[model samples]
Target: MENKLIVSSSPHVRSNQDTSYIMKQVVIATFVTMVGMLLKAYIPALGDALGLFIPLIVVNCLILARAESFASKNTPIKSAVDGIGMGLGFTLALTALGVVREILGNGTLFGMGLFGASYQPALLFILPPGAFLSLGFLLAGFNKLKNKKA
Candidate 1:
């Protein structure tokens, strides 16, 4: 006769994987991408090199914590997909915020002044609080869209 073991949670079921493993993968992926971006910025001397990596590192740490707490037990494919989704989402949000701030603060997109000399730029849009305010409203907008779909 073959012997078998019963797996359960609180007297029910259990699995081989756990949260830590998933989190490690997420951290590795995030680090890989951030490092790539850093190298790109450093080599070409493009954009705000220091600021770019700082935000990436900050967001990566936040994602790492979340993945450890919630995503580690899942399968590799699922975890990868989730990580990609989150990365893309973060990129989109940041890009949108950057675009708004750049256009408003510099009166330009990609450093070209659209408003010419007549427009006085709003300096506040480029400040730290601007990023937070933009993100807050973006989150609210996303929530509204989600609610509408449901």
Candidate 2:
């Protein structure tokens, strides 16, 4: 029964939980983080809107569309693995961009001032173009790596 459950046509399983489930999970997580941001905004020590929540939602939607369109029909286990991989990929990509931007734009990592006070920050790294350029290149790199492995 287990073997049969794992085998089928090109897509090995069918279920009600498709890309929508993944998207819903991601949206929920994002909303939770956004609420944290809102709380920080109200605090005197952290009173800035990072603008991350909106982009996170957009990225989550894109991921949902891709997963639903490509991975939904696969076996449940496979689909779950794929979802985890995609989530990790998204997180790593985002973290890399944030690290680069923070180091260049603020001369610090976690506000510790790694580069010292003499360092002149590149303010553009925190701007919209920085996110686009970083994400675009990271995506291209991921595609290249995936194709090479394939």
Candidate 3:
């Protein structure tokens, strides 16, 4: 009577959690924290410039959309590749826009004058409306190129 073995009516249950899946989540979290810390520490100016946007990168729509639509269903390596490709595409697009905006608005590329002392920058390009015009033109150019390729 002292030793009794009793079994419940519930079925056996097992968890689907695995080492790799848990490790991947931990690594991603650690990486994002480290990036935010490093940005705050080493690049204060850029951190200030970016403000909340830098910290919000993890929850950005582009990242969230890709993670849900693809990363969750794909292998880690494939997901990483997709992330890298998307990051590069984003970087390139921003660089192109910046180059155009800076040259037209300030007559400079990264604070170095490209058009010499006599150059007169278009003040309109430096204003808020100029940003919209620049983006629209860039999108149009990219679309034209894409269409030509097809």
- Candidate 2 per-residue C-alpha lDDT over 1-150 given as tens digits, one digit per residue, 9 for 90 to 100: 322233322251334335434545555556656665666767634434544554466566667766775574688788888989998987887799888788877889986998777889888778978767766766798899999999
Position 26, candidate 2: lDDT: 52
Best by TM-score: 1
Candidate 1 residue pairs that clash: 7-13, 8-12, 8-13, 9-13
Task: Report the C-alpha displacement of residue 50, candidate 2, in angstroms.
Answer: 12
lDDT: worst 10-residue window of model 1: 1-10
What is the RMSD, in Å, between candidate 1 and the native fold over all Cα?
11.0
- Score every model by TM-score: 0.56, 0.55, 0.53
Rank all candidate structures by their lDDT, best first, as comma-separated numbers: 3, 2, 1
Candidate 3 local lDDT, 27-76, one digit each (tens): 45556667777888999887678776754654354455555557778999
Please, what is the whole-model Cα lDDT of each candidate in the order they appear? 0.66, 0.67, 0.69
lDDT score of residue 22 within candidate 1:
45
The runs of at least 3 residues in candidate 1 whose Cα sits more than 4 Å from the true structure, single-residue gaps closed, are: 1-56, 144-150
* Model 3 misplaced stretches (Cα beyond 4 Å): 1-59
lDDT score of residue 30 within candidate 1: 60
